[model samples]
Each structure stands twice: as structure tokens, then as C-alpha cells.
Target: MNITKNKFILLFLCLILLLIASFFLALSYGNAQIPLDSIADIVINHLVYGIKSNDENGALYDIIWLLRMPRIILAICVGAGLSVCGVVMQAIVKNPLADPYILGISSGASLGATAAVLLGIGSTLGENFIGISAFMGALGISFLVLFIANLGGPANSVKLLLAGMALSAICSAFSSFIVYFANNMEGIQTITYWLMGSLAGANWPLLSKLVPLILICIFLLWSQAKILNLMLLGDDTAITLGYNLQIYRQSYLLITSLMIGTIVYASGVLGFVGLLIPHLVRMLIGTDHKYLIPVSALIGASFLIVCDLCCRIILPRAELPIGLLISLIGAPTFIYMMIRKTYSFGSK
Candidate 1:
């Protein structure tokens, strides 16, 4: 046991170092071709002392601090949050294929945001009406999924998945219906961008709210690591071991919904990070949640920072959507995994 624990600690340290390296690499490379030294200087000034400049170097500083930094941070936070939720969801449901979005939360958030934009249903709220609407939608769908899954018997993995899919279909249909009839060109344009998922809109104010929420969720889920390990043994065995997963499952889902709502509100539906990173980490470290959660978070954060850097530099001037980039990369990898029979969505 001690040896296993030591190995996990070593893996965690290695992942953290990798994350820092990726962060530096992400800061250094971009289309404008800023030198690594200049980037380092800006980061040092911001981190070490409060220095504000608007000169050429300052403009670079601003771009790094205001534009690129927030986006990178957003990527990291969203990646970590999604990966953490993915780990928790998989344990709760005892399904390797489970993800944070599997319970229809992302769809719900999307529908809410879409309605707010196209229909202007929540326009009277304020500047953040779209985000608020998204939160409500995600929460609503979570509740619906929980209720539906608990209908016949104990909330099991199969039932939870089915409920989530069904609710997701319903929310998607409603969103499309609103999009179809809405004659607002500007609204449609905004909706399209929101769907594609970009970190271009990252701002400090949003991050201030989002980062703390995500941190709290990560902490809560991390503390449940032991319980998550027991969950893989199935309900009957888990019950004999004296752990009641019912409340834990529901509570984690709700917390995850809150995190997902904020993420969707911040960066639309950035998919695959949650599903892929946790699975990959599990493959490396085994299914022990104690090691899986934090390590996956670090890997997820590093993965997005790199991916975002690619999206910035890969094009001539314009930026590509991160979600599209993830899909392009993830789909083929997923196919390869399926063909190799390494790990799959095979039923229990």
C-alpha cells in the first residue's frame, strides 16, 4: 500500500511539472512570434510585482496578461473541472464511458444559452442573462435525469445514462426549435459562436467567479476519492462495505452541474477533454480515484493549454474554435482506441 501511494505521489509531482512546462510553452508560442525572453519577463513582472505598461512590450504584456492569459487560464480551469467531473461521474455510474456531459448538463446549458440569445426570454435579467439561463438549464436537466433514473429502482449506471440521453435529446430539440423560427440574424450569429466554444471571450471578472467555484468542486470531489474506489465494485458490494453512494452520487452530480454551468457560460461546449483525459489517466494509474482525480486534472489542463496554443498559431490571422480542434484530434484517437480493444464502452 505504501509503495502504491508513493508511486501516486511521484506521478502527481511529474504531472504538475509537466503542467508548468506546458504553461510556459503556451505563453512563448503564438502567431505574433513573441520571444521566449519577453514572455518570461512579462510573466515575471505580473507575478512578482504589480507592473502595468502599454508600450510595445506593454502591449505584448497586455496581450499575454489580458487576452492570452485569461484564455489559457480558462482552458485550464475548464479542463480540470471537466476531467474531475468525468472521474466522479464514471465512479458514480460505474461506467468507463461516463463523462461530465453524459447526464445532459451540457445540452441543458446549451439550450438555455440558445434560448436566452434567440428568444430573448431572459433578456430582462441583465448583462449575464445568457449565463444565468444556462445555469438554470443545466440544473433543471440534472434534476430531471436524477428523477428519471430513480423511477423504477436504485439509480444505476444504465438508467442514469438512458435518462441523460433522453433529456439531452429533448433539450436539443427545443434549442433547435428556437433557432429555426428566430428571425434575428445577430442572435443567430452569436448562437453559432457560442455553440462552437471559444476561449476568446475570457475575462478576469468571469474567471474570478469561475475559478473559485471550480476549485471548490475539485476539492469536494477529491475528498471522495476513497468512496469512488468502492463504487467500481458495484452497489451490492459497496453497500456491504458500509458506503451509501446514493447521496454521494446525487450531490456530486449537482456540484458537477454547477461547475458545468459555469464552464458552459464561460466557454460553450468544449467536449472530449473530460471523456479522454480521465480515461487516459485511468489507464496509466489504474482506476484508483485517489490518484486519478488530481493527475487527470493536471493532464487535462496541460492538454487544453497546448491545444489552445495550436489553435492560435495554426492559422494565419484568425483563430479556430477550440472545440473543433478537440473533436478533430479526439475522434481519430477514439477510433484507434476502439479498434485496439484497449478499453471501451463495453457493458457490465
Candidate 2:
């Protein structure tokens, strides 16, 4: 017991250090290549002394503080949120393949975004039309999935997964229909980039707004770690032990949707962080939600920050899409893990 506990503590500390180091690595390795010392100086002077980096108007300071900071922070928030959600969804559905997007939320958000960009559907909602539409679409799909699952029976994992797959297909079909009929070349280009996911739209206002939501959701999730463990025993076993997963499942789905919507708003349709991070963490820590949730959050945040750094510097003149970059890396890693038979996808 002591040995296992100590390993957990050690790995947790490493995750913290890795996150901090990756933050600086992200800040320093962009196109203009700000030095580590300069990046630290700018951040400390502005944050500790209540000074704005832009006040002195150095381009490097401005770039680091103004441009890179928001993107990096948003990346961390989105990564952590998605990774934690991935863990929760897999637990709820009792399926390793379940991800944050399993319930069609991503497709719903994409459909909303396509409508806003091509048909100008949300034009009256002011400048943030696309984001607002996407949020509503994701939230709506979550509710629809829950509703469908609850139709004829007490919504179990199998029903929920099936409902999600069905809704996801419908949403994707709608998105394609709109894209085909609209014939708006410019909007199609925009949707293409947005679908591939970019942190370019990140800003101070959006990051500040999402900070509390992300932090609160993660805390609530961590608090529920004990019950999540009980859930893995299957419904009958959990019920015999006096834990009803129904209310918990619905509540988790709703709360997680907020985080998902926030990410879809800030970054757009980035995948794999949710699916990949939890599996990696579980391979090391076993199935303890106590260790899994927080570690997954930390690793997820670090992974995205580091990946986004690669996206930015991989090309001299243009940045790679983050979604594509992550998919390229994550797909093979997951395949290798599956092939190794080290971590079965919920199979005992």
C-alpha cells in the first residue's frame, strides 16, 4: 500500500512540474522565439507588480503576454476539462471508447457553427454569434441524448451510448446538408479550419470567463471520485451496495456539457485529449478514480500545451491545425497500446 501510494504522489508531483515547464516551453517557442528569461520577466512583472506588458510597448512582451498567454491558458483549460470529461464519460457508459464527443455534442456544436458561418443564422446575436450557437447546440444535444436514453427504460449505459451514436449521426448529416446546399466558398473554408480546431480565437475575455466554470466542474468531478469507482462494479452490484447511478449519470452529463461547450467555443472540435489522457493515466495508476481524475487533468493540459507549441513552430510561415496534429499523434499511440494488451478497454 505504501509503495503504491508513494508512486502516486511522485507521479502527481511530476505532472505539476511538467505542466509548469510546458507553459514556459509554450510561451518561449513560438514563431518570434522569446527567450525563457524574458518570458518569465514579462509574466512576473505584469502579474506581480500590477503592470501591463503593453504599457512599455515592447513587441516581444506584447506578443508573449497579449497573444501567447491567452492561447496557452485556454489550451490548458480546454485540455484539462476535456480529459476529465473523458474519464467521467467512460465511467458512466462503462465503455472505454466513450469520449466527450460520444453523445454527438461535438457534431451538434459543429452544425451550429456551420449554420452561423454559412447561413448567418445567428447574426442578430451580435459578434459572438457562432460561439453562442455552438454552445446551445452542444447543450441541446446532451439533453436530447439523456431524454432519448430515458424514453422506455431507466437510462442505462447501453441505451445512452446508442442514443448518443444515433444523435451524432443525425447531427453530422445535418451539418453536411447545410455545407452542401449553402455553396458559400468562404464559409466552407472557415468551417474547415474551425473543424480542425485552432486556438487562434482565444483571448483574455474568453479565458477569464471560462476559468471559474472549468475549475468548478473539475472540483465537482474530483469530489465524485469515490462514487465513480462504485459505478465500475456494474448497475446491479452498485445498487445492491446502495448507490443509484441514474441521478449521478444525468447530472454528470449535464455538468460536463458546460465544459465541452466552453472548449468548442474557445478552440473548436479538438479530439483525443479526453479519450487518450485517461487511458494513459489509468495504465499507470490502475483504476483508482482518486488518482485518475486529477492526474488526467494535469497530463491533458500539458499534452495540449505542448502539442499547440508544435503546431505553432512546425511551419515557418503557417501554423498547423491543432486537431489534425493531435489526431496524427494520438491515433498511433492508442493503436500501439491496444496492440500491447497492457491496458484492456474495461475488459477484466
Candidate 3:
């Protein structure tokens, strides 16, 4: 057993190294034709030998640092955050299909961002007011869903999902109402683009807003591995074992809302990541959150990096939105999983 576990750790570490290499490659390759040798030289000079970009006005370094690097890091953060949320939600709700966005959080965030952009409701909050509003929207909806679900019962999985769906409808309608009455063409266009989701706006300034929150979410969820394991055993079992999951579940939902809100605000509603990546990792490593969270984080990050790279390369001088790309890839995989007839949707 120890030998098997050691082998598993070694294999997972190897995958992580490969993911890191892929992240670097993503930073190097883009629309411009920068040579790999120069890419390596530039990296080494900047790191091992503290050198600056050769051309003060050149774009190579800008592309590597401002554009590509930030986008890549955002991809990693969004991917990891979503996957962690998925794992935690699944465990807490005792349903494999439960994902962060399934609880109307994304729609609420969208509504908040839309309100900010269209009505200028929070313009006083500064440039990233949309992001701030979106985060609050997500958190508010999460709390509402939890409250409504737990109204008459212990908030089982079915009730939670029902509450989420109902709240999603309400939020979507409000968003549509805002868009319908808003007379700004440019605002409508911006909202449309944001709904599709892109890494085009990635920059250090924007990244700084989210990186700390993402790191803290990662650490907090990682520390809850054992609790997550217990959570999967159902609430009654957890209660019998003297572990009341009500507060834990609510706290986790808040954390998930915060993390996913940052991602949606940064890139705008990237989908399929939480739903797909966590399921894939569970298939590989079992339902133990101790192993599940970290592995899911690394794998989801790598998957998003590759997907973003494909988005960059798939077109000629035009880029596809990463969210659409994930949907395209994930929809087919989801269909295949359903058709295979091998695994139940939510089973131990």
C-alpha cells in the first residue's frame, strides 16, 4: 500500500512539473514570432541575472510580462478556484453535480457586473467597481440560497439545488431587464463581450486584485480536506460523529463565492471548469479531499492553460473566448460520459 501511494505521489508530482513547463510554454508562444531561444534567454536574464527588456519601447517583454503572463496566471487561478469550489460543494451537498455556479452565484455576479457597467450604479467605487459589485452579488446570492434551502429542513442537496435554480432565474431576469432598458450601444457591446469571457483584459493591476484572494481560498479549502471527507458521509453521519457541518458548509460557500466572483469579474463567466475538472480528478484519485483538492487544482490549472493556448492558436489574428472554448470541449466530454453508461452521475 505504501509503495502504491508513493508511486501515486511521484506520478502526481510529474504531472505538476509538466503543468509548470506548459505554463512557461504558454507564456512564450503567442501571435508574435518570438524565437524559443530568445524566450529562454530573456527569462534567464530577467531571473537568474536581473536584466531588463533589451528594447525600452519594444513589445516582446510586454507580451511576455503584461499580456501573456497575467493571462496565464489568471487562467491558473480561475481554474484552481473553480475546481476547488466544485470539490467542496460536491462534498458538502453530497452530490457530484453540484458546482459553484450551479447555485446562481455566477448569474448573480453577472447581474452585479451588468448593473455596474450599464447603470453606473457603483461608479463611485472606482475603475473596478464592476468587479467589486460582482463579488458582493455572488456572496449575497450564496447566502440567500443557503437561507432559503435551510428554511424548513437541514438543507439537503435537492433543496439547495432548487433554491439555486430559483435564484438563478430571478437574477437572469433582472440582468435582462437592465439590458433591455439600457440605451447605450457601447455598454451593451461590452456586456456581450464580457459574457463570452476573455483574458484580453489581463494585467498586473487587475491580477493584484485577485491573487491574494485565490491563494487564501486555496489554503483554506486545502486545510478542510478531512472535513470534506466527512461531509461526503452525509449530514446525519457527520452529526453523529460530532461534526456539525452547517457552519462549515456556509463558510465554504462564502469562500467559493468569493473566489469564483474574482474569476468571473476578471474574465467573465468561464464555465465547465468546475463541473468537469473536479469530476475528472475524482475519477483518477477517488473522493478523498486530502488528495482531491491539490490534484484538482494542478490539473484544472494545466487544462485551462492548454485551453487558453488553443484559443490563441486556433484562429488567425483573432482569438476565441476561453469560456466558449471550454464549453466546446466540455460539452462533448459531458455527452460522452453520459453515453458511456459506465458511471452513475453521482455515486460513490
Candidate 4:
């Protein structure tokens, strides 16, 4: 017993070290390729002496502290948030394919942001119009999906999945229709990037709110680990064990939708983290939510930070969209997982 416990402790400690290493490594590389020591100096000097280093080297400091830092941090939050949400959503629906974005939330966000950009409906919201509109769209679509799923009778996992797909299709159609009619080249470019996802919007002002929301959601989801585990055992079995998923499912769905919506508003649509990260963690640590939640979150954070770094360096003068890169990687991994019978999505 002690040996197993000790092994998990050691594993987690090592994971923390890995996360720190990844953070520093991400900070060091970008278009300019800043050095590790410079990265450390910028953070340490600013944090300790309460001074902003400005001069010849100040430009590097600004790039790291202002640009790279916030984006990387946003990547971590979105990655961790989406990964944890994926784990719970999969458990809620008892389907391995489930993810935060699999529902209509991300599409809804995209639609809202696209409308704001192209149609100028929410342009009056000020600088954060896109984000504000996206969040509203996400929340509204989530409620719509839930309401639709419950229209005929009690909502089930299958119903939720189906309803999400229906709304997602509807939202996608509207987005396409809007673009098709707009005929503005510059507007099209902005909408394209927003749909593809970018962390370029990261900054302290937004990060301040994003970080706390992610932390709180991760903590809340982690606390529900036991309930999540029960959920995987099927509705009948969960009820027999003194738990009711019907009640808990909506609560979890609502919470996850909020987290995903915030992420989309902050970072745009980042796919596959939710779908890919949890599955990879399950392969490493099995299906136990207690272990799955945190491990998946950490790995997801590392995964996105690395992906964001790749996007920056992969192209010389231009950067790639994060959503595009993730889809490129996620699709292959998903195919491999589905082909392998060993993992079996969930317990038989």
C-alpha cells in the first residue's frame, strides 16, 4: 500500500518538474528566440526589484514578459481546462469520444465572434467585443442544447450528444452563411484566424481573469472525482451506489460549458486537447478520475505550450493558428487510439 502511494507521489512530483521545465522552455523560444537566462532575468528582475528592464535588452524583456508570457499562460489554462473538461465529459456520457468542444459550445462561440466581426452586432461592447459576444453565444447555445435534449423526455447521454451535434451543425451553417454573404476580404481574414484559434490575444489584463477562472474550475472538477468515477459505472449502477447522475450530469455539463466558453473567448477554438489529452492520460494511469483529472490537466498544459511554441517557430515570418495544428496532431492520435483495442474507451 505504501509503495503504491509513494509511487504516485513521486510521479506527481516529477510531473510538476516537467511542467516547470516546459514553461521555461516555451518562454525561451519564439520568432526572436530569446535565451533562457534572459527569460529568467526578465521575470526575476521585474518580480523582485519591482523594476521594468528597459534599454537595448529591454525589447527582449518586453517580448517575453508582455507577448510570450501571457500567450503561454493562456495556453496552459485553456489546455488544462479543456483537458479536465474532456475527462469529466467523457465520464458523464460514458463515451470516450466526448470532449468539451464536441458539444455545441465551441461552435456557438465561433458563431458569435464571427457575427461580431462581420455583422458588427456586438461591436459596441468595446475592445473585448469578440470575447464578450463569444461567451454569450457559448452560454446561449449550451442552454439551447440542453433544452433541446430535454424536449421529448429525460435527457440521456446519447440525447445530449445528438443534440449538441444538431446545434453544432446549425451554428456552423450560420457561420458559413454569414461569411458567404459578407464578401469583405479583410473581415474574412480576421474571421479565419479567430476560427482557427490564436493565443496572440493574451495579455495580463485578460490573463488576470482567465487564470483564476481556470484554477477554480480545475479545483472544482477535481473535487468531484469520486462522483465522476461513479458516473462511468452506468446510470443504474451509479444509482445503486447512492448517487444520481441525472442530477449531477446537468451540473457538470453546465460547469464544463462555462469553462470551455471562457476558454474560447480567451484563446479562440482550440480542439483536440480535450479529446486527446484525457485519452493519453488514461493510457498512462488508467481510468480512475482521481488520477486522471490532474495528470491530464498537467499533460494538456505541457502539450499546448509545446504546440504554441511550434506554431511560432514552424514558419519563419508567419505563425500558424493553434487550432489548425492541434487538429493536425489530434486526428492521427485519435485514429490510433480507436484502432487499438487495449484501451477500450471505457470499462466493458
Ranking, TM-score, top scorer first: 2, 4, 1, 3
What TM-score quantifies how close candidate 3 is to the native fold?
A: 0.92
lDDT of each: 0.83, 0.88, 0.81, 0.86
Best by lDDT: 2
What would the per-residue lDDT of candidate 1 be over residues 1-348, giving only the tens digit for each residue? Answer: 112888888888888898888887877778766677888788777778767664657779877888887888998998899889888888877777778888888889889999999888799999878878887898899999999999988787678889999999999999889989999999999878777788888999999988999998899989988877777777777788887778778887888888887888888888888888877775576676777888889998999899999999899898988999999998887666656644433123
Error of 1 at 212 (Å): 1.6
Write model 3 residue lDDT over 1-348, tens digit each, in one string. Answer: 012467669868987897888888897677876667777776777788877577752467777766788899988888888888888877767777778789999889889889988999888998878777887788889889999988987776677778898999999999999999999999989877777788777888877878888989999999998888887777778889999888788788778887887787787888788888877775566666777788888888898899999899899899988888899999899667656534333334
lDDT-sorted candidate list, best first: 2, 4, 1, 3
Which sections of candidate 3 miss by over 4 Å?
Answer: 1-4, 341-347
Q: Model 4: how far is 4 from its true place, Å? A: 4.5
- lDDT (0-100) at residue 337 of candidate 1? 62
Residue-level error in angstroms, candidate 2, position 43: 1.8
Q: Which ten residues in a row have the lowest lDDT in candidate 1?
A: 339-348
Top candidate (TM-score): 2
